[model samples]
Target: METELDIEEESDDAVLGSYEEPVRLVDDAAAEILILWATNQPVVWKQNFFVRQTSLSFSLDACGQIFTIIQSPSAMVKPGVTGAVLWDSGVVLAKFLEHAVDTKRLHLLGKKVVELGSGCGLVGCVAALLGASVILTDLPDRLKLLKKNVDANVGIPVTTRGYVKVLELTWGDELDPHFINPFPDFVVGSDVIYSEDAVVDLLQTLSQLSGSHTTIFLAGELRNEAVLEFFLEAALEEFQIGCIDQKRWHPEYRSCRVALFVLVKKSLSCM
Candidate 1:
């Protein structure tokens, strides 16, 4: 059964999501416009569509080079709103933790990794170039832009230490066959567990992707009390949780408190 809100939402999205080819003006200037995926629905990939209000910047970081996407007041990927995005929810924090597995870091030895909800694929981009096999996952709608980000940044193939692969994975949907590894050795996500409706699907995906030796790294801004409660309950099955780190994204940045959580999957022996 669907609620009235859901019904109306679907209707609006369908009506708004009509697309045609890019139109060219009399001069050489041209503009590309596409359907909004599902109008009024939350944007599946924030980086894909070119909106007038935003710009992407490549920033140098202590860990390595990562892209910074800045959102502005006039930017309207949607209607009447300004959005602040640090990194894709699962990607920004994953970038913070990359030292462990990155060859340049000299700490972690494993190179295989995956990031869910990779909005701009910054973390995966860095990892793949640093000599690890990295898989970047997000919705199909975003893959076009995600691929663009990869192409825009990495000029040479990262054959020495890393490889980047983009995958389309919606929360709760069945896992794609691209990953033959069965369970990933390490799963890192950031800011991914915010939506209450999407929590169960997220947990289900995590459970299916982790093993006893697997390390699951998560980072998020606490949206509200309900979000925290949902996480406590959803990921309780396989993970022996530990609150590893917490901090603000920027010193003066308000409403942007970030926390890092490390959960080790406990198999029968550990239990």
Candidate 2:
């Protein structure tokens, strides 16, 4: 007797539980970048045909800060070196985090945070600025650039106010207890949900890093709906998923192509 809409609502409730409300935290400029990427436009990149090394600057209005990221030229980036470049979703997420903290929608002060697939370490740096101890992780080869950006923006061996550390984390590998014993209060990722082959591993890593009190924020460009759907299906098994409303952020950042999800550990009963 359930209508399609009823069934859909029930399914969403089952997967999302009490966190069904959308929290807006994206801007229109960020939204436009995602749209361009979805349409195969080169708005974020410098060269049309090839990737080019470039320096880019992002402004955090809430804190009146600017981050300069050095992007490796596409020519120098070999296979499996995608993390050398900054992506639009990363920028969007960084901006959203800044907006969230400014508006008091999310608290990062005195919290431990981890960023997965932290290309260029922009989001991690922003987290540090917002008063969260941050661990930025990517593949081993990508650590150099990631560390450079983090150090350049956040300084080395940061103090108790907020610290930033770079680590090599290959998805699906056994998590190190030393790095995650207490579990971070918040986990963040940007443009990480691309490969169909990597989705399972990515979800596994997320599950391992999350505790009952942990919340995860993931922002990804909608390149392939099927791939995104696959990730959501797998993620639902371990976490309660909520979509953050575009309206919660600056009007300039809302995008039809860029999506943000907030994930929390599912209750034991639900599990």
lDDT for model 2 comes to 0.69
Check candidate 1 and list the clashing pairs.
Answer: 13-39, 53-75, 89-190, 90-190, 131-161, 131-162, 132-161, 132-162
RMSD of each: 17.4, 7.2
- lDDT for 211 (candidate 1): 54
State the TM-score for model 2: 0.78
Consecutive 10-residue window with the lowest summed lDDT within model 1: 14-23
Q: What is the C-alpha lDDT of each candidate?
A: 0.50, 0.69
Q: Each model's TM-score, in the order given? A: 0.64, 0.78
Model 2 segments more than 4 A misplaced: 1-62, 75-77, 157-159, 268-271
**For model 2, what is the alpha-carbon lDDT of residue 253?**
55
